[model samples]
Target: MKKRIYKDIKIRKLFKRYEIRRRLLLGLINDLSIPLEKRMEFVSQLNRLPRNASKVRTLNRCVLTGRSKSVYRFCKVSRLALRDLGSQGLIPGLSKKSW
Candidate 1:
């Protein structure tokens, strides 16, 4: 799990470095005005980037427990951790609602 987080962070850093280029290539690849051969070249260049650098490759982990599943992106935490913190009143503006 730790290794996964480390790898995710590393890939994220690499992605940041190539982000602008990736977006530009992606845009060019989709542009109809670009020649088919040039578009193919852009596609190949995009594919040459490390697979891990793609945003889809990164797994979201809980900020408190480092759990990789059931993460709430808005809160940046796992449901379990969020529930625990809310119950404890440690998470501001969050609480356990009772019927």
Candidate 2:
């Protein structure tokens, strides 16, 4: 019997892009102190970037939010925004101490 190998190639690709965008947006939010509600708009702009952009190697949006903006504008996870996110759980794992 041959061993079977299962790999979700599509998911892997999507996740890779998601992670990149997530990190980039997080950094921008932290530095700019942008609100969560407005972050989506910024992310949407980035999602439209040309495919050649190295930061977003792939084109994929956050599944939870279902917004292409997730590809660019990430909710601020800094201590300042943590209090709000904590109460609302708007962005997961975004804690005051994470920064």
| lDDT string, candidate 2, 2-99, tens digits | 11111223445555656677667657656657777677776776676543444434334433333333333354233444455576767677455553
In model 1, the clashing pairs are none
Best by lDDT: 1
Residue lDDT tens for model 1, 49-92:
87777778778888778898999999899999998888889988
Cα-based RMSD of the predictions, in order? 1.8, 17.4
Alpha-carbon lDDT of model 1: 0.86
Candidate 1 lDDT for residue 15 = 79
Give lDDT: candidate 2, residue 58.
36
lDDT of 2: 0.49
Candidate with best TM-score: 1
